[model samples]
Target: MYGLMSILVHSIMYTKFITPLGIDASLNRFFEARAIDHVQVLAHEIDGRQERRQGLKEAAEYIKAQLERLKERAGSNFRIEIEENAVGGSFNMMFLGHGISFGYRNHTNILVRIVNSYF
Candidate 1:
């Protein structure tokens, strides 16, 4: 199973030129160990479905819980939007000169968006 690192909700803002604020910015100094714990949880608890294509919703729920926790710790004026939906798609690829085609069916997709009111 692959592990996950604890992520800051503001880190999402970095994608759009936003920086962490107050307690959120200071978290990396104190939450280094907590990040490792997150890794362990993702590697174990969430592995129940992550290794397969069937349990993404469970992982998404876990992520939502984490985000909620971070939201509480964030300074101010930051809003988080977490979106989940059932999505399906297909793709084709070449592997070792062999034709490979795959499809996503009944798959759950989760998207997170961070909105900074100050901006």
Candidate 2:
């Protein structure tokens, strides 16, 4: 798992344009410790399935916290913004033979957005 995470982080870093050269080093150090933590927190703690409204809210807060931490580390000029909006509810449905159907409604989603910033 560690190896996979390292590869994923490196791949992500490679895709972004590193500025000032020094930022690359800082980003490398930052992601080394935080990337896995972020993934675990989002994937495990933030359950987005049906009936998990609180979980969705918690996930949004978690993302905001992470962004704030990054902004603080990156310096005073860095800015982060978060927005929440209500989306139409969705239904999960499955149809079986003999005209049987099963479905459940899922609440709105919490959207997280990271503003323009240089890393």
Per-candidate Cα lDDT values, in order, are 0.68, 0.60
Regions of model 1 farther than 4 Å from truth: 1-30, 48-54
Please estimate how well model 1 matches the true structure, expressed as its whole-model Cα lDDT.
0.68
Error of 1 at 65 (Å): 1.6
| 50-101 per-residue lDDT for model 1 (tens digits) | 3244456677677778877777766678887777787788899999999999
Stretches of model 2 off by over 4 angstroms after superposition: 1-32, 45-50, 76-79, 91-119
Q: Assess candidate 2 and give its TM-score to the true structure.
A: 0.43
Q: What is the lDDT of residue 45 in candidate 1?
A: 67
Itemize residue pairs with steric clashes in candidate 2: none
Report the C-alpha lDDT of model 2 over 1-119, residue by residue, as the tens digit. 99999999999988866443332456526544456668888898778734546786677677767666665665454465545565554345546634544443443444545454656
Per-candidate clash tally: 0, 0
Cα TM-score of candidate 1: 0.60
Give the clashing pairs for model 1: none
